[model samples]
Target: MLQIESTFDVQGDFGDSGLGKLLDMFRDMSDHDEDPGRFVVEKVIEKIPAPLRWAAEPFEAVLGAEVNDQLDALVPGAGDEIQAIAGALSDRARKFAIRSVLDVGLDAKGRKTGTHRIETIIQVFKEARLELPATELGDKLAPATRIPITLGAGEFEISEHRLKFPAGTMLSRALPRLVIPGVLGKVIESAALIARWFACADTAAKVAEKLDDPRAGAIAMTACASASKSISDQIEERLAKIDEEGRLRLEGSADEEGEGTYPAGGWRGAFRIDKEVEASIDPQRNTFSTQEQMATQ
Candidate 1:
């Protein structure tokens, strides 16, 4: 019940291991010629409780069949389209980029819990700039034509990551639609699934010691939502309205001042993870601060 309300945005490449591993899992399920159903139930759904294991049956049923082609089209080539859309949104937000890869290690016996690890890096630039055209005054005075502005550049490392998906809800809502047939159906299904995953994913990170402004948190969250929406748009324009079509809502369970948690609160729109200052930055009390940073502050 860590309810710190915020928007989360990710824009960048999914390292070879992040989304690639997920795709590999899907591909494995599809390519297991001998016993694809067993593979899904065993490798993929093994972590699910016994009673709930049946919940994922639909996913198992559809593997290694005609759906393979549709799945291929849906998740083509290490998610290039997804990265492109995220990058565009990141550029639009003027925020840092995120490079991540998630790896889940299933138990060999298919009866034990697995390990889920997410490695993420935040690529921050010291400043952002916009060039201006030379004017008569500038030509005469030799004034600078480009303006450098602060863009909240700071290094952050996600020391740990956690995923909290409602298995029942995901399976029930998305798996049913998987049988709709055609690539569009697969896209729609995948879109819903991805959106939910974004909403459910959480991270624990260390940031620059000076990064204490709540606006950074809000901006990050908003950017993350926009990034997720961009992915939805890539899948299908109409569904870009994910908030409405996908029932996407971000809720938080924290108390006033954004410092409390509610464990029993079933659904959370925002989660606040404990953070530590990984590094310290001295801006020289505005001496080294850019005009943009001063204004934002």
Candidate 2:
């Protein structure tokens, strides 16, 4: 068996980059209160790299006007229902801020030991709920039913690191079957509803596989939208900082290691891909893979 270990540091801005442009457009829409309609989102979609287009295309369907039009025809006030869900989610997301901590314990031998655990904590000072109209789904669901948006603080540990596999490898296997948390899960439920409305049974089924029960309304989703913008801004800011020289060190065995630096070539310069890892291992087998990102503006 060949044991491999690596460490890398890379930083760069989206300067005139497609991703930067995409993030900027989203930020502008959220900041300026402009509607992120299908047409505008399509323009944003164009800014996504070719490799990411497929993953992003589904969202277009999820957020597009055509889908809303379709849903309104099927569920009458479905559009309002979605909006209410999104708003409810946004309220929940806003109620708690994410805090992270790194707890490290050293062994007496002075060798790095202990869990070296890092965790992201969502601390909720108070729990809150948003009410949604149940008549949209039918009388069985409660209209006055308060969907819990924020809950007791939960801690998620960041212990495992994944190596960057090729773009589609991980996503293709994970997305269709992945079950996500309540925040986005509610949105997925709405998406599944929309997909079924279009008679896109396959899309609906796939979306259904990712759904969580008892959806949160628009307010919760609104918070997710806000969080999405925050995430976009953070990514853009980090990418913008990649300058001059970037470094990578790879160790294939206890005795063998390679270290190198590549010029970020400044912004918008052609990026060079220095390495590629090909493994034929089964997708079910968990393994670690790491790759450095090099991008041109």
lDDT measured at residue 119 in model 2 versus the true structure, 0 to 100: 20
| TM-score of candidate 2 versus the correct structure, residues matched by position | 0.24
Q: What is the C-alpha lDDT of each candidate?
A: 0.26, 0.28
Model 1: per-residue Cα lDDT over 121-162, one tens digit each: 122322322211222112221221111111122311112223
RMSD score of candidate 1 (Å) = 25.6
TM-score of each predicted structure versus truth? 0.19, 0.24
- Model 2, 1-297: lDDT tens digits are 111112121222334433333334334433322222343344434444454444556666454465456555665655444444333332322222211112222245533221211122122211332222212223221122111111112311122222211111111121222223433344344322122223233323322333321222222233334434544454334233221111111111111122321211111111211232111212222122222311211
Q: After superposition, which runs of candidate 1 have C-alpha atoms over 4 Å from their true positions?
A: 1-44, 47-67, 72-191, 194-273, 277-297
Clashes of each: 12, 32
| Model 2 spans > 4 angstroms off | 1-69, 80-101, 110-114, 121-187, 190-297
